[model samples]
Target: MACLKLDARALNGLWNADHWERELSDPRRICVGIAEGSDNLSAVACGWIVLDELQITVVAVDPEHRRQGLGRTVLKQLLLDASSAGARQAFLDVAEDNHGALALYGALGFHTIGRRSGYYRNGKDALIQSLELQTDIKLN
Candidate 1:
Protein backbone atom coordinates (compact mmCIF):
# COMPACT_ATOMS: atom_id res chain seq x y z
CA MET A 1 0.00 0.00 0.00
CA ALA A 2 1.05 3.65 -0.23
CA CYS A 3 1.61 3.83 3.53
CA LEU A 4 4.09 0.96 3.26
CA LYS A 5 6.24 2.96 0.89
CA LEU A 6 6.20 5.95 3.19
CA ASP A 7 6.78 3.64 6.13
CA ALA A 8 9.96 2.31 4.57
CA ARG A 9 11.25 5.83 4.17
CA ALA A 10 10.02 7.17 7.50
CA LEU A 11 9.56 4.33 9.98
CA ASN A 12 11.98 1.70 11.23
CA GLY A 13 10.31 -1.74 11.20
CA LEU A 14 7.44 -0.47 13.28
CA TRP A 15 4.66 -2.20 11.36
CA ASN A 16 4.45 -3.97 8.03
CA ALA A 17 1.97 -3.73 5.19
CA ASP A 18 0.37 -7.03 6.10
CA HIS A 19 -0.09 -5.92 9.68
CA TRP A 20 -1.53 -2.59 8.59
CA GLU A 21 -3.90 -4.23 6.17
CA ARG A 22 -5.22 -6.47 8.90
CA GLU A 23 -5.59 -3.68 11.39
CA LEU A 24 -7.23 -1.34 8.91
CA SER A 25 -9.93 -3.90 8.35
CA ASP A 26 -11.03 -3.65 11.96
CA PRO A 27 -14.16 -1.54 12.45
CA ARG A 28 -12.81 0.24 15.53
CA ARG A 29 -9.76 1.59 13.73
CA ILE A 30 -9.55 5.18 12.56
CA CYS A 31 -7.07 6.65 10.10
CA VAL A 32 -6.24 10.05 8.67
CA GLY A 33 -4.07 10.40 5.59
CA ILE A 34 -2.69 13.12 3.36
CA ALA A 35 -1.55 12.39 -0.15
CA GLU A 36 0.18 14.49 -2.75
CA GLY A 37 -1.24 12.42 -5.59
CA SER A 38 -3.20 9.26 -6.11
CA ASP A 39 -0.17 7.13 -5.33
CA ASN A 40 1.91 9.37 -3.10
CA LEU A 41 1.02 9.32 0.57
CA SER A 42 2.60 12.24 2.42
CA ALA A 43 1.53 11.48 5.95
CA VAL A 44 -0.82 9.25 7.95
CA ALA A 45 -2.10 8.81 11.48
CA CYS A 46 -3.90 5.69 12.63
CA GLY A 47 -5.53 4.70 15.90
CA TRP A 48 -7.88 2.20 17.44
CA ILE A 49 -10.78 3.04 19.68
CA VAL A 50 -11.09 0.89 22.78
CA LEU A 51 -13.75 1.68 25.36
CA ASP A 52 -13.21 5.37 26.20
CA GLU A 53 -9.68 5.51 24.86
CA LEU A 54 -7.95 6.01 21.55
CA GLN A 55 -4.82 3.97 21.09
CA ILE A 56 -2.65 5.77 18.59
CA THR A 57 -0.89 3.08 16.66
CA VAL A 58 1.30 4.91 14.23
CA VAL A 59 2.10 8.24 12.67
CA ALA A 60 4.36 8.38 9.67
CA VAL A 61 5.45 11.14 7.35
CA ASP A 62 7.56 10.93 4.25
CA PRO A 63 11.13 12.07 4.86
CA GLU A 64 10.76 14.56 2.04
CA HIS A 65 7.64 15.95 3.73
CA ARG A 66 8.94 16.40 7.25
CA ARG A 67 8.74 19.64 9.30
CA GLN A 68 5.79 20.95 7.31
CA GLY A 69 3.06 20.25 9.89
CA LEU A 70 1.69 17.23 8.06
CA GLY A 71 2.09 15.00 11.10
CA ARG A 72 0.37 17.45 13.36
CA THR A 73 -2.46 17.98 10.90
CA VAL A 74 -3.22 14.33 10.45
CA LEU A 75 -2.85 13.53 14.14
CA LYS A 76 -5.17 16.35 15.08
CA GLN A 77 -7.75 15.08 12.66
CA LEU A 78 -7.44 11.60 14.15
CA LEU A 79 -7.93 12.96 17.64
CA LEU A 80 -10.94 14.98 16.60
CA ASP A 81 -12.57 12.02 14.94
CA ALA A 82 -11.81 9.78 17.89
CA SER A 83 -13.29 12.26 20.29
CA SER A 84 -16.42 12.38 18.23
CA ALA A 85 -16.53 8.62 18.40
CA GLY A 86 -16.62 8.74 22.21
CA ALA A 87 -12.93 8.45 23.01
CA ARG A 88 -12.17 10.40 26.17
CA GLN A 89 -8.42 9.84 26.09
CA ALA A 90 -5.62 9.27 23.61
CA PHE A 91 -2.33 7.46 24.07
CA LEU A 92 0.71 6.33 22.15
CA ASP A 93 4.11 4.81 22.67
CA VAL A 94 6.96 6.72 21.13
CA ALA A 95 10.57 5.67 21.03
CA GLU A 96 12.66 7.43 23.65
CA ASP A 97 15.14 8.68 21.08
CA ASN A 98 12.50 9.99 18.72
CA HIS A 99 12.83 13.56 19.83
CA GLY A 100 10.78 14.93 16.99
CA ALA A 101 7.82 12.72 17.80
CA LEU A 102 8.16 13.41 21.51
CA ALA A 103 8.12 17.13 20.85
CA LEU A 104 5.10 16.85 18.60
CA TYR A 105 3.18 14.79 21.14
CA GLY A 106 4.21 17.14 23.88
CA ALA A 107 2.97 20.10 21.93
CA LEU A 108 -0.34 18.31 21.54
CA GLY A 109 -0.64 18.04 25.34
CA PHE A 110 0.42 14.43 25.69
CA HIS A 111 2.52 13.75 28.78
CA THR A 112 4.64 10.77 29.61
CA ILE A 113 2.59 8.31 31.61
CA GLY A 114 4.84 5.25 31.56
CA ARG A 115 7.77 3.58 29.81
CA ARG A 116 8.57 0.22 28.34
CA SER A 117 12.15 -0.98 28.49
CA GLY A 118 13.50 -2.43 25.21
CA TYR A 119 10.14 -2.01 23.59
CA TYR A 120 11.26 -2.05 19.99
CA ARG A 121 13.14 -4.66 18.01
CA ASN A 122 16.09 -2.27 17.97
CA GLY A 123 16.11 -2.19 21.77
CA LYS A 124 14.83 1.35 22.16
CA ASP A 125 12.77 2.27 25.18
CA ALA A 126 9.20 3.32 24.44
CA LEU A 127 7.72 6.23 26.30
CA ILE A 128 4.00 5.92 26.84
CA GLN A 129 2.31 9.27 26.55
CA SER A 130 -1.31 10.16 27.16
CA LEU A 131 -3.69 13.05 26.68
CA GLU A 132 -7.08 13.65 28.19
CA LEU A 133 -9.39 14.46 25.35
CA GLN A 134 -12.49 16.59 25.64
CA THR A 135 -15.22 16.82 23.09
CA ASP A 136 -14.61 20.52 22.78
CA ILE A 137 -10.84 20.40 23.13
CA LYS A 138 -9.01 22.68 20.78
CA LEU A 139 -5.94 20.96 19.45
CA ASN A 140 -3.69 23.69 18.15
Candidate 2:
Protein backbone atom coordinates (compact mmCIF):
# COMPACT_ATOMS: atom_id res chain seq x y z
CA MET A 1 0.00 0.00 0.00
CA ALA A 2 2.58 2.57 1.04
CA CYS A 3 5.14 1.07 -1.28
CA LEU A 4 2.69 1.33 -4.14
CA LYS A 5 2.50 5.07 -3.47
CA LEU A 6 6.28 5.17 -3.30
CA ASP A 7 6.87 3.28 -6.57
CA ALA A 8 7.57 6.47 -8.41
CA ARG A 9 8.44 8.77 -5.52
CA ALA A 10 11.04 6.52 -3.98
CA LEU A 11 11.34 3.07 -5.62
CA ASN A 12 11.82 4.32 -9.18
CA GLY A 13 9.02 2.03 -10.33
CA LEU A 14 10.93 -1.14 -9.51
CA TRP A 15 7.78 -2.63 -7.91
CA ASN A 16 4.04 -2.46 -8.26
CA ALA A 17 0.96 -3.33 -6.26
CA ASP A 18 0.96 -6.89 -7.56
CA HIS A 19 4.57 -7.35 -6.60
CA TRP A 20 3.88 -6.21 -3.04
CA GLU A 21 0.84 -8.48 -2.84
CA ARG A 22 2.83 -11.50 -3.97
CA GLU A 23 5.69 -10.84 -1.60
CA LEU A 24 3.29 -10.19 1.25
CA SER A 25 1.67 -13.55 0.66
CA ASP A 26 4.97 -15.37 1.09
CA PRO A 27 5.44 -16.84 4.52
CA ARG A 28 9.21 -16.44 4.45
CA ARG A 29 9.10 -12.71 3.94
CA ILE A 30 9.20 -10.11 6.69
CA CYS A 31 7.89 -6.60 6.19
CA VAL A 32 7.80 -3.64 8.58
CA GLY A 33 6.22 -0.31 7.90
CA ILE A 34 5.51 3.00 9.62
CA ALA A 35 2.42 4.93 8.72
CA GLU A 36 2.18 8.71 8.61
CA GLY A 37 -1.58 8.66 8.80
CA SER A 38 -4.48 6.41 8.08
CA ASP A 39 -3.78 6.35 4.35
CA ASN A 40 -0.08 7.11 4.06
CA LEU A 41 3.15 5.37 4.98
CA SER A 42 6.28 7.14 6.17
CA ALA A 43 8.75 4.31 5.87
CA VAL A 44 8.99 0.61 5.04
CA ALA A 45 11.53 -2.22 5.15
CA CYS A 46 11.25 -5.82 4.02
CA GLY A 47 13.40 -8.93 3.87
CA TRP A 48 13.28 -12.59 2.84
CA ILE A 49 14.20 -15.40 5.17
CA VAL A 50 16.15 -18.36 3.78
CA LEU A 51 17.32 -20.89 6.31
CA ASP A 52 19.45 -18.93 8.78
CA GLU A 53 19.86 -15.90 6.57
CA LEU A 54 17.87 -12.81 5.71
CA GLN A 55 18.16 -11.02 2.37
CA ILE A 56 16.89 -7.50 2.75
CA THR A 57 14.92 -6.61 -0.35
CA VAL A 58 13.56 -3.13 0.21
CA VAL A 59 14.11 -0.13 2.49
CA ALA A 60 12.41 3.08 1.58
CA VAL A 61 11.36 6.30 3.26
CA ASP A 62 9.17 8.85 1.66
CA PRO A 63 11.12 11.94 0.58
CA GLU A 64 9.09 14.12 2.86
CA HIS A 65 9.80 11.81 5.76
CA ARG A 66 13.57 11.38 5.38
CA ARG A 67 16.04 12.08 8.22
CA GLN A 68 13.47 11.69 10.96
CA GLY A 69 14.32 8.19 12.22
CA LEU A 70 11.44 6.45 10.45
CA GLY A 71 13.82 4.47 8.28
CA ARG A 72 15.79 3.33 11.31
CA THR A 73 12.66 2.34 13.20
CA VAL A 74 11.18 0.26 10.41
CA LEU A 75 14.48 -1.42 9.61
CA LYS A 76 15.10 -2.32 13.25
CA GLN A 77 11.66 -3.91 13.47
CA LEU A 78 12.21 -5.79 10.21
CA LEU A 79 15.52 -7.17 11.46
CA LEU A 80 13.95 -8.22 14.74
CA ASP A 81 11.17 -9.98 12.89
CA ALA A 82 13.70 -11.78 10.73
CA SER A 83 15.69 -12.84 13.76
CA SER A 84 12.54 -14.16 15.41
CA ALA A 85 11.89 -16.09 12.21
CA GLY A 86 15.21 -17.92 12.69
CA ALA A 87 17.54 -15.70 10.70
CA ARG A 88 21.02 -15.65 12.18
CA GLN A 89 22.31 -13.02 9.80
CA ALA A 90 21.12 -10.36 7.39
CA PHE A 91 22.37 -9.09 4.04
CA LEU A 92 21.60 -6.23 1.72
CA ASP A 93 23.00 -4.36 -1.27
CA VAL A 94 22.93 -0.59 -1.28
CA ALA A 95 24.12 1.89 -3.86
CA GLU A 96 27.58 3.11 -2.99
CA ASP A 97 26.53 6.75 -3.09
CA ASN A 98 23.67 6.36 -0.65
CA HIS A 99 25.42 7.83 2.37
CA GLY A 100 22.31 7.98 4.50
CA ALA A 101 21.63 4.29 4.10
CA LEU A 102 25.28 3.34 4.55
CA ALA A 103 25.38 5.34 7.77
CA LEU A 104 22.19 3.74 9.02
CA TYR A 105 23.39 0.23 8.25
CA GLY A 106 26.74 0.90 9.82
CA ALA A 107 25.13 2.21 12.96
CA LEU A 108 23.12 -1.00 13.10
CA GLY A 109 26.39 -3.00 13.00
CA PHE A 110 26.32 -4.13 9.38
CA HIS A 111 29.75 -4.47 7.78
CA THR A 112 30.67 -4.37 4.15
CA ILE A 113 31.22 -7.82 2.69
CA GLY A 114 31.48 -7.21 -1.07
CA ARG A 115 30.77 -4.90 -3.96
CA ARG A 116 29.14 -5.13 -7.35
CA SER A 117 30.16 -2.78 -10.12
CA GLY A 118 27.42 -1.02 -12.05
CA TYR A 119 24.77 -2.85 -10.14
CA TYR A 120 22.02 -0.33 -10.64
CA ARG A 121 20.27 0.95 -13.76
CA ASN A 122 21.94 4.30 -13.18
CA GLY A 123 25.42 2.71 -13.13
CA LYS A 124 25.99 2.99 -9.42
CA ASP A 125 28.13 0.44 -7.64
CA ALA A 126 26.40 -1.69 -5.02
CA LEU A 127 27.97 -2.35 -1.67
CA ILE A 128 26.95 -5.61 -0.07
CA GLN A 129 26.73 -5.56 3.70
CA SER A 130 25.99 -8.13 6.37
CA LEU A 131 25.04 -8.15 10.01
CA GLU A 132 25.03 -10.96 12.51
CA LEU A 133 21.78 -11.13 14.41
CA GLN A 134 21.37 -12.04 18.04
CA THR A 135 18.08 -13.27 19.35
CA ASP A 136 18.64 -11.32 22.52
CA ILE A 137 20.05 -8.20 20.93
CA LYS A 138 18.73 -4.97 22.35
CA LEU A 139 17.02 -2.84 19.72
CA ASN A 140 16.00 -0.02 22.01
Candidate 3:
Protein backbone atom coordinates (compact mmCIF):
# COMPACT_ATOMS: atom_id res chain seq x y z
CA MET A 1 0.00 0.00 0.00
CA ALA A 2 1.22 3.46 -0.89
CA CYS A 3 0.55 6.43 1.33
CA LEU A 4 2.53 9.65 1.06
CA LYS A 5 3.28 9.32 -2.63
CA LEU A 6 -0.29 8.79 -3.84
CA ASP A 7 -1.41 11.23 -6.55
CA ALA A 8 -4.29 11.82 -8.90
CA ARG A 9 -2.70 9.97 -11.78
CA ALA A 10 -2.28 6.85 -9.64
CA LEU A 11 -5.86 7.10 -8.35
CA ASN A 12 -7.25 7.60 -11.83
CA GLY A 13 -5.55 4.39 -12.91
CA LEU A 14 -7.76 2.41 -10.56
CA TRP A 15 -11.03 4.29 -10.97
CA ASN A 16 -12.57 7.15 -12.85
CA ALA A 17 -10.23 9.91 -13.90
CA ASP A 18 -12.83 12.65 -13.94
CA HIS A 19 -12.00 15.50 -11.55
CA TRP A 20 -9.63 13.34 -9.52
CA GLU A 21 -6.82 15.79 -10.04
CA ARG A 22 -8.60 18.46 -8.08
CA GLU A 23 -9.77 16.08 -5.38
CA LEU A 24 -6.27 14.70 -4.80
CA SER A 25 -4.75 18.13 -4.89
CA ASP A 26 -6.76 19.16 -1.85
CA PRO A 27 -4.80 19.71 1.34
CA ARG A 28 -6.58 16.91 3.14
CA ARG A 29 -4.77 13.72 4.12
CA ILE A 30 -4.94 10.77 1.74
CA CYS A 31 -3.89 7.12 1.53
CA VAL A 32 -3.83 4.62 -1.32
CA GLY A 33 -3.33 0.89 -1.83
CA ILE A 34 -1.58 -0.38 -4.89
CA ALA A 35 -1.26 -3.83 -6.38
CA GLU A 36 2.19 -5.23 -5.75
CA GLY A 37 4.63 -5.33 -8.68
CA SER A 38 2.35 -3.13 -10.73
CA ASP A 39 1.28 0.49 -10.99
CA ASN A 40 -2.43 -0.43 -10.76
CA LEU A 41 -4.09 0.71 -7.59
CA SER A 42 -6.34 -1.71 -5.74
CA ALA A 43 -7.84 0.66 -3.22
CA VAL A 44 -7.89 4.32 -2.20
CA ALA A 45 -8.93 6.10 1.00
CA CYS A 46 -8.91 9.85 1.58
CA GLY A 47 -9.74 11.89 4.65
CA TRP A 48 -8.54 14.63 6.94
CA ILE A 49 -7.79 14.88 10.61
CA VAL A 50 -9.96 17.48 12.32
CA LEU A 51 -9.18 17.89 15.97
CA ASP A 52 -9.71 14.39 17.33
CA GLU A 53 -11.70 13.14 14.38
CA LEU A 54 -10.58 11.72 11.08
CA GLN A 55 -13.33 12.50 8.60
CA ILE A 56 -13.08 10.18 5.66
CA THR A 57 -14.24 11.64 2.39
CA VAL A 58 -13.67 8.64 0.15
CA VAL A 59 -12.86 4.93 0.29
CA ALA A 60 -13.10 2.86 -2.84
CA VAL A 61 -11.74 -0.38 -4.24
CA ASP A 62 -11.60 -1.43 -7.82
CA PRO A 63 -14.64 -3.53 -8.71
CA GLU A 64 -12.42 -6.34 -9.82
CA HIS A 65 -10.57 -6.24 -6.52
CA ARG A 66 -13.61 -6.20 -4.28
CA ARG A 67 -14.24 -9.08 -1.84
CA GLN A 68 -10.52 -9.69 -1.54
CA GLY A 69 -10.00 -7.72 1.68
CA LEU A 70 -8.16 -4.90 -0.07
CA GLY A 71 -10.61 -2.30 1.10
CA ARG A 72 -10.47 -3.57 4.64
CA THR A 73 -6.71 -3.54 4.63
CA VAL A 74 -6.63 -0.03 3.27
CA LEU A 75 -9.15 1.26 5.79
CA LYS A 76 -7.45 -0.50 8.67
CA GLN A 77 -4.16 1.04 7.76
CA LEU A 78 -5.69 4.48 7.37
CA LEU A 79 -7.32 4.25 10.77
CA LEU A 80 -4.09 3.19 12.42
CA ASP A 81 -2.14 5.92 10.70
CA ALA A 82 -4.74 8.52 11.53
CA SER A 83 -4.85 7.43 15.13
CA SER A 84 -1.10 7.74 15.34
CA ALA A 85 -1.52 11.22 13.94
CA GLY A 86 -3.62 12.11 17.02
CA ALA A 87 -7.06 11.25 15.70
CA ARG A 88 -9.13 9.43 18.28
CA GLN A 89 -12.15 8.82 16.07
CA ALA A 90 -12.83 8.01 12.45
CA PHE A 91 -15.97 8.86 10.44
CA LEU A 92 -17.23 8.05 7.00
CA ASP A 93 -20.39 7.98 4.91
CA VAL A 94 -21.44 4.90 3.06
CA ALA A 95 -24.32 4.49 0.66
CA GLU A 96 -27.20 2.66 2.32
CA ASP A 97 -27.35 0.12 -0.47
CA ASN A 98 -23.65 -0.58 -0.52
CA HIS A 99 -23.80 -3.83 1.38
CA GLY A 100 -20.16 -4.71 0.79
CA ALA A 101 -18.90 -1.47 2.21
CA LEU A 102 -21.39 -1.49 5.05
CA ALA A 103 -20.31 -4.99 5.99
CA LEU A 104 -16.64 -4.11 5.81
CA TYR A 105 -17.04 -1.04 7.99
CA GLY A 106 -19.19 -2.95 10.44
CA ALA A 107 -16.59 -5.68 10.75
CA LEU A 108 -14.00 -3.04 11.44
CA GLY A 109 -15.88 -1.78 14.52
CA PHE A 110 -17.74 1.12 12.98
CA HIS A 111 -21.32 1.77 14.02
CA THR A 112 -23.97 3.89 12.43
CA ILE A 113 -24.21 7.31 14.00
CA GLY A 114 -26.72 8.98 11.72
CA ARG A 115 -28.07 9.20 8.19
CA ARG A 116 -28.24 11.81 5.48
CA SER A 117 -31.25 11.84 3.19
CA GLY A 118 -30.49 12.17 -0.49
CA TYR A 119 -26.83 12.55 0.16
CA TYR A 120 -25.61 10.94 -3.01
CA ARG A 121 -25.89 12.28 -6.52
CA ASN A 122 -28.02 9.24 -7.28
CA GLY A 123 -30.39 10.32 -4.52
CA LYS A 124 -29.56 7.47 -2.23
CA ASP A 125 -29.41 7.90 1.51
CA ALA A 126 -26.00 7.77 3.18
CA LEU A 127 -25.31 6.02 6.45
CA ILE A 128 -22.91 7.91 8.61
CA GLN A 129 -20.64 5.67 10.65
CA SER A 130 -17.91 6.30 13.16
CA LEU A 131 -15.28 4.22 14.92
CA GLU A 132 -13.31 4.90 18.06
CA LEU A 133 -9.73 4.09 17.28
CA GLN A 134 -7.87 2.09 19.86
CA THR A 135 -4.44 2.91 18.61
CA ASP A 136 -2.92 0.18 20.74
CA ILE A 137 -5.02 -2.51 19.11
CA LYS A 138 -3.22 -4.03 16.20
CA LEU A 139 -5.16 -5.01 13.13
CA ASN A 140 -4.86 -8.60 11.93
Candidate 4:
Protein backbone atom coordinates (compact mmCIF):
# COMPACT_ATOMS: atom_id res chain seq x y z
CA MET A 1 0.00 0.00 0.00
CA ALA A 2 1.09 3.54 -0.71
CA CYS A 3 0.26 6.50 1.48
CA LEU A 4 0.73 9.69 -0.51
CA LYS A 5 -0.33 13.31 -0.58
CA LEU A 6 -3.38 13.50 -2.83
CA ASP A 7 -3.83 16.25 -5.33
CA ALA A 8 -6.98 16.99 -7.31
CA ARG A 9 -5.95 14.63 -10.09
CA ALA A 10 -5.28 11.81 -7.70
CA LEU A 11 -8.51 12.42 -5.85
CA ASN A 12 -10.33 12.39 -9.13
CA GLY A 13 -8.76 9.11 -10.00
CA LEU A 14 -9.84 7.68 -6.68
CA TRP A 15 -13.57 8.46 -7.24
CA ASN A 16 -13.86 11.33 -4.71
CA ALA A 17 -14.70 14.32 -6.86
CA ASP A 18 -17.54 15.67 -4.74
CA HIS A 19 -15.05 17.03 -2.19
CA TRP A 20 -12.21 17.78 -4.54
CA GLU A 21 -12.33 21.49 -3.94
CA ARG A 22 -12.11 21.14 -0.17
CA GLU A 23 -9.31 18.62 -0.47
CA LEU A 24 -7.34 20.69 -2.96
CA SER A 25 -7.80 24.05 -1.26
CA ASP A 26 -6.45 22.69 2.02
CA PRO A 27 -3.61 20.23 2.00
CA ARG A 28 -3.93 19.39 5.67
CA ARG A 29 -7.44 18.04 5.15
CA ILE A 30 -6.45 15.19 2.89
CA CYS A 31 -4.92 11.75 3.24
CA VAL A 32 -5.03 9.03 0.58
CA GLY A 33 -4.07 5.38 0.72
CA ILE A 34 -3.37 3.60 -2.51
CA ALA A 35 -2.75 -0.01 -3.24
CA GLU A 36 -0.75 0.13 -6.41
CA GLY A 37 -0.98 -2.40 -9.13
CA SER A 38 1.18 -2.84 -12.18
CA ASP A 39 -1.38 -0.92 -14.18
CA ASN A 40 -3.55 0.96 -11.71
CA LEU A 41 -4.73 1.36 -8.14
CA SER A 42 -6.36 -1.67 -6.58
CA ALA A 43 -7.70 0.13 -3.50
CA VAL A 44 -7.97 3.67 -2.20
CA ALA A 45 -8.97 5.40 1.01
CA CYS A 46 -9.36 9.14 1.49
CA GLY A 47 -9.91 11.18 4.62
CA TRP A 48 -9.58 14.63 6.08
CA ILE A 49 -8.63 16.10 9.43
CA VAL A 50 -10.27 19.22 10.83
CA LEU A 51 -9.55 20.38 14.36
CA ASP A 52 -9.70 17.34 16.63
CA GLU A 53 -11.85 15.30 14.30
CA LEU A 54 -10.73 13.06 11.51
CA GLN A 55 -13.41 12.49 8.90
CA ILE A 56 -13.08 9.60 6.57
CA THR A 57 -14.53 10.79 3.29
CA VAL A 58 -14.19 7.82 1.02
CA VAL A 59 -12.81 4.32 0.81
CA ALA A 60 -12.97 1.99 -2.19
CA VAL A 61 -11.47 -1.28 -3.16
CA ASP A 62 -11.58 -2.60 -6.69
CA PRO A 63 -14.26 -5.23 -7.18
CA GLU A 64 -11.64 -7.87 -7.80
CA HIS A 65 -9.91 -7.02 -4.54
CA ARG A 66 -12.91 -7.06 -2.24
CA ARG A 67 -12.81 -9.24 0.90
CA GLN A 68 -9.01 -9.28 0.82
CA GLY A 69 -8.54 -7.13 3.96
CA LEU A 70 -7.16 -4.23 1.95
CA GLY A 71 -9.88 -1.84 3.09
CA ARG A 72 -9.29 -2.64 6.75
CA THR A 73 -5.57 -2.15 6.35
CA VAL A 74 -6.05 1.21 4.72
CA LEU A 75 -8.53 2.46 7.31
CA LYS A 76 -6.40 1.30 10.22
CA GLN A 77 -3.40 3.14 8.88
CA LEU A 78 -5.43 6.25 8.20
CA LEU A 79 -6.65 6.29 11.80
CA LEU A 80 -3.14 5.90 13.12
CA ASP A 81 -1.94 8.72 10.91
CA ALA A 82 -4.84 10.90 12.00
CA SER A 83 -4.05 10.30 15.68
CA SER A 84 -0.44 11.16 15.07
CA ALA A 85 -1.60 14.33 13.38
CA GLY A 86 -3.45 15.37 16.56
CA ALA A 87 -6.92 14.06 15.88
CA ARG A 88 -8.71 13.20 19.12
CA GLN A 89 -11.66 11.54 17.42
CA ALA A 90 -12.49 9.96 14.09
CA PHE A 91 -15.76 9.92 12.18
CA LEU A 92 -17.21 8.34 9.08
CA ASP A 93 -20.55 7.63 7.47
CA VAL A 94 -21.27 4.33 5.86
CA ALA A 95 -24.29 3.28 3.88
CA GLU A 96 -26.67 1.39 6.13
CA ASP A 97 -26.64 -1.58 3.81
CA ASN A 98 -22.89 -1.87 3.57
CA HIS A 99 -22.33 -4.75 5.96
CA GLY A 100 -18.67 -5.11 5.05
CA ALA A 101 -17.86 -1.53 5.97
CA LEU A 102 -19.95 -1.69 9.12
CA ALA A 103 -18.02 -4.73 10.23
CA LEU A 104 -14.69 -3.13 9.43
CA TYR A 105 -15.47 0.04 11.35
CA GLY A 106 -16.91 -1.96 14.22
CA ALA A 107 -13.72 -3.97 14.47
CA LEU A 108 -11.79 -0.73 14.65
CA GLY A 109 -13.75 0.43 17.71
CA PHE A 110 -16.20 2.78 16.02
CA HIS A 111 -19.72 3.00 17.36
CA THR A 112 -22.79 4.45 15.76
CA ILE A 113 -23.34 8.02 16.89
CA GLY A 114 -26.30 8.90 14.67
CA ARG A 115 -27.91 8.45 11.30
CA ARG A 116 -28.75 10.55 8.29
CA SER A 117 -31.88 9.56 6.47
CA GLY A 118 -31.58 9.37 2.68
CA TYR A 119 -27.98 10.41 2.88
CA TYR A 120 -26.86 8.64 -0.24
CA ARG A 121 -27.80 9.44 -3.80
CA ASN A 122 -29.58 6.11 -3.97
CA GLY A 123 -31.77 7.04 -1.00
CA LYS A 124 -29.99 4.80 1.44
CA ASP A 125 -29.57 5.99 4.99
CA ALA A 126 -26.08 6.64 6.32
CA LEU A 127 -24.94 5.46 9.72
CA ILE A 128 -22.59 7.93 11.32
CA GLN A 129 -19.92 6.33 13.44
CA SER A 130 -17.24 7.72 15.70
CA LEU A 131 -14.18 6.45 17.44
CA GLU A 132 -12.36 8.11 20.32
CA LEU A 133 -8.69 7.87 19.62
CA GLN A 134 -6.39 6.89 22.43
CA THR A 135 -2.70 7.46 21.97
CA ASP A 136 -1.98 4.31 23.93
CA ILE A 137 -4.09 2.11 21.62
CA LYS A 138 -2.18 0.10 19.09
CA LEU A 139 -3.51 0.43 15.56
CA ASN A 140 -2.11 -2.78 14.19
Instruction: State each model's CA lDDT, in order.
Output: 0.90, 0.87, 0.74, 0.72
Model 2, 1-140: lDDT tens per residue? 66788656777778888898977789889888888677687788999999999999999998888999988999999998988888999999999999999999988888899999999999999999999998333466
- Which portions of model 3 miss their true places by more than 4 Å? 1-19, 22-28, 36-38, 135-138
The residue-by-residue lDDT of candidate 4 on 28-88, one tens digit each, is: 7655555465435666666888898899887766666679888787778788888889998
Pairs in clash, predicted candidate 3: none
* Candidate 4 Cα misplacement greater than 4 A, ranges: 1-25, 37-39, 135-140
Which residue runs does candidate 2 get wrong by more than 4 Å?
135-140
Error of 2 at 22 (Å): 1.6
**TM agreement with the true structure for every prediction:** 0.94, 0.92, 0.78, 0.78
Model 1 stretches astray by more than 4 angstroms? 135-138
For 109-135, candidate 1 gives per-residue lDDT tens digits of 889989999998889999999999983
For residue 39, model 1's alpha carbon misses the true position, in angstroms, by 1.0
Report the lDDT tens digits of candidate 3 across residue range 1-140.
23222333333433344445645666557565656556566677778888888998778776667788888888888888888888988999988998988888888888999999999777999999988897433376
